[model samples]
Target: MESVGITIRLFGAFRKFGNGSEIEISVRCGTNLKELRVLLSQYLRENDPKFSETLVVDSAIANDTKILTNDFCIEKSCTLAILPPVCGG
Candidate 1:
């Protein structure tokens, strides 16, 4: 079976998703950003429900930029950065 690896960088309130700094997650080749978000949500929910609740409450995934699968193809490397909504005066 083929595997895909990605380094997810969490920013702002989203940093609570994983321990310490960034998180490295492995997914099957061909996984899209939407799927990745779901997987990430599961990991966060297991590790910290407070972060998970925040993610859900704030609709974090919905606001994320679409991340293409490497070359926009399945079976390729990809990176994702999660950030919370920002507002300015």
Candidate 2:
């Protein structure tokens, strides 16, 4: 998995993996963030049935240092942060 080298940081209540606030995931190089969301959704739904919705919609992804669209292209191994939707009145 080290060869893939994609680090994901979970924020809010997204850390379902039970390993602090960060985790390392593997994905094919050049995979877009949207595609990554689908991959993550599949895993989450299988492990935690409650998370049926894909991350593409349920959360925002911070690519490197900026909040980008799901279609943002991931060129190399980098750190991504998952932020649950902002809800407040």
Candidate 3:
């Protein structure tokens, strides 16, 4: 591990990424949400190769119940919830 870690939470159809509701991942200090996404993409490409293209498939990133932006540097380790896209009949 390089620095502190963060938990990447998955919901809805995004559960395939972690094979469950949540998964813990490590990231280097100063990593932003966008960079974290890149790390996640790599992780998926390595672990869940099939779900690589479906990561949330269009989702929102949240931290402590608040939405996080690309520039939001993840200085503190915490849980990030990824809410997948909604679908209806």
Candidate 4:
């Protein structure tokens, strides 16, 4: 299976994954947000001992324009942002 590299900009708690704010992840072609989330969560768990599964479940994935639904399929390599749930009062 062919795969593409996707660059995801980390936000909130996700920034703790590495020294940089962005990380490149490779996914099989035609992967969607739901699948990507699982892959990312696994990657995080492997890379960071403090990673939590709920973070990926609660986060939102957005392209240059808007937040994408889990069913949205990514066909090409691109830069996207993962915005973790935010709370402000």
**Best lDDT among the predictions, by candidate number:** 4
Q: Candidate 4 has which clashing residue pairs, if any?
A: none
lDDT of 1 by residue, 1-89 (tens): 68888777777776655665578889888776566667777888788656554563343432236633423433676555665576658
Q: Which scores higher on lDDT, 3 or 4?
A: 4
After superposition, the stretches of candidate 2 with alpha carbons farther than 4 Å from their true spots are 1-3, 54-56, 87-89
- RMSD, each candidate, Å? 4.5, 2.9, 2.5, 1.3
Residue-wise lDDT of candidate 3 within 40-67, one digit each (tens)? 7777778766765455436778876688
Full candidate order by TM-score, most accurate first = 4, 3, 2, 1
Query: TM-score of every model?
Result: 0.66, 0.77, 0.80, 0.91
TM-score, prediction 2: 0.77
Best by TM-score: 4
Residues 1-89, candidate 4, lDDT per residue (tens digit)?
Answer: 88999999988788877666899989999998999999998899999778789988889999889989999988999999999888879
| Window of ten residues with lowest summed lDDT in model 2 | 1-10
The lowest-lDDT stretch of 10 consecutive residues in candidate 4 is 11-20
TM-score of candidate 4 to 2 decimals: 0.91
* lDDT computed for candidate 4: 0.89
lDDT for position 5 in model 2: 67
Distance from true position, residue 4, model 1, in Å? Answer: 1.3
* Candidate 4 off by > 4 Å: none
